[model samples]
Target: MSIKDIDDIVVHDISKFRPQEDISLDSTKKKIVEKIKLQLKLNNTSIRKLAEKTGMKHPQILRVTSGENYNIETLIRILDALNLEILIKEKDKNSNDQLMNTAAL
Candidate 1:
């Protein structure tokens, strides 16, 4: 059956749609660091090599790659060195699930 062939479709009210909650910077930063580490591994780069390329300390880079808390500036530098850009957008305030779904998409 085609979508237009359906006779019992219901449309939800957009006014009732909830906005999504924003993710904490810490959680988002951690995810970004992990992704960068994965990409580095795929490129055959070591942790030390990444640190050197980013002009960050080897120990600090290790901590970041291991999911330790680091400053936003440090994270930004690392991402930039990896050719990644951080995009920040104000999230809707009603629904966390919706925000996550949108981000995933």
Candidate 2:
């Protein structure tokens, strides 16, 4: 099923589920880096090769790919090297399945 369909079908107050304590930016960055690495199959590339291709140090590449702390600049560089772009969108306030179906078409 499309993400929109799933989003429409599933009803939950995500705001309530958010952690009470502030989440560390490092943790958030690490999760995003790991997700991108997995999606792009970065692990298949050797550290030296990735470093050479991305113009980043081998250690930094390893750290970012391995879900360790990485700077935003590093993340952007890695994404650029992989020819990927990040998109940020606000969720629709209306939970309309019909809208989702139309969007899918």
Please name the candidate that would achieve the greatest TM-score relative to the true structure. 1
Top lDDT prediction, candidate number: 1
Q: Candidate 1, which segments miss by more than 4 Å at Cα?
A: 1-26, 92-105
Candidate 2 lDDT over residue span 1-105, tens digit each = 998887788545553444423233444566677676675675576667778998889898878887776777998888777777777786454634443443344
Clashes of each: 3, 0
Residue 89 lDDT (model 2): 81
Candidate 1 structure quality by residue, lDDT tens digits, 1-105 = 887868667656542343322344445656777798888878888888888998888998877787777788987888787778888787656655565665554
Q: What is the C-alpha lDDT of each candidate?
A: 0.73, 0.67
lDDT score for candidate 1 against the true structure: 0.73
- Model 1: lDDT of residue 34: 77
Q: By TM-score, how accurate is candidate 1?
A: 0.58
- Residue pairs in collision within model 2: none
Worst lDDT 10-window in candidate 2: 15-24
Task: State the displacement of the C-alpha of residue 19, model 2, in Å, after optimal TM-score superposition.
Answer: 5.2
Deviation from native of the Cα of residue 17 in model 2, angstroms: 14
